[model samples]
Target: MFVIVGLGNPGKQYAGTRHNVGFDVIDYLSEKHNIPVNKVKFKGLIGEGFISNKKVLLVKPQTYMNLSGHSVLEIQNFYKLNPEQLIVIYDDIDVDLGKLRIRSKGSAGTHNGMRSIIYEIQSDQFPRVRIGIGKPQKGDLSNHVLSRFGKEDQEEMAITIGNAASAIETVVTEGVNAAMNKFNG
Candidate 1:
């Protein structure tokens, strides 16, 4: 089984914010795959189901962004899964808005969530899907990530989230290379 983790802060206040795009993608995947992510496990909201014949655990960590690793590590250890069997999805301010960058393994860069996962898991050799939110034009970075999108950007983000869900499906059904070829344009 593959463990798919989407990083974001929990609670209603964080919903629809740029930092919550990971959660949005998880929500999209849950709805599309008929998986209800209502179970609390591994310090996250999880739904167990199949994606193209492959058993999967869709997770939304409730430990907030910076401490996401705690939830992820629990699931990893419980399942005895290798890093390769894990797929992490989160937002990236460095990439252009509504875009995606898929990697099989890499550094966390500026994302504290990714950093925490890498630190707790003791490796960076895991697949990851990064949704672009773009950098702040001005003001504090935290404010920018916590802010909601404008009307125009919301439409674009909707498409992006759908694409992100599709990308993850491809990753599960095919492989990281195939997903990268299809969605990493």
Candidate 2:
């Protein structure tokens, strides 16, 4: 079994913000697989189903971005899963918008959500799928992540979300290496 977590702030105000891309991917996957993520557990919404014949628990941490680890730790402990069974999806400012970078394990860097998960779980040896949100051209970093995409980028954002969903399916069916080879570009 694998726990696929998408890091994002909860609430309607943050629904379409750049920081919520992780949630977006979770939503996309839920719909694609016909799994309803309506269960309130582990301080997050979760949907259990089989993806590519592998048992997967789709998670959206509701503890907001910075405190995401609390929720993740709960799920991890409940499932008795190893660090490698965790697959996190979140936004990254270091990469260009609409791009993806998959890693078997790595540091969180500037993402507070990832940091929280790593700190709480006591491990970073987990697969992560980072969707690029692009650095802010100017102004505060918080503002950039909290902001919604412009009309020009909406199309690209949609495509990226879809790709992220597919990439996750690939990860479950094949392996992290297969997913990285196919989606990380």
- Candidate 1 weakest lDDT stretch, 10 residues: 1-10
Steric clash pairs (candidate 1): none
TM-score of 2: 0.99
Residue-level lDDT of model 2, residues 13-108, one tens digit each, is 999999999999999999988889999999999999988889999999999999999999999899899998999999999989999999999999
Instruction: Name the runs in model 1 displaced over 4 angstroms.
Output: none
lDDT of 2 at 77: 90
Report the CA-based lDDT of candidate 1 relative to the real structure: 0.95
Candidate 1: lDDT of 179? 99
Candidate 1 vs. true structure, TM-score = 0.99
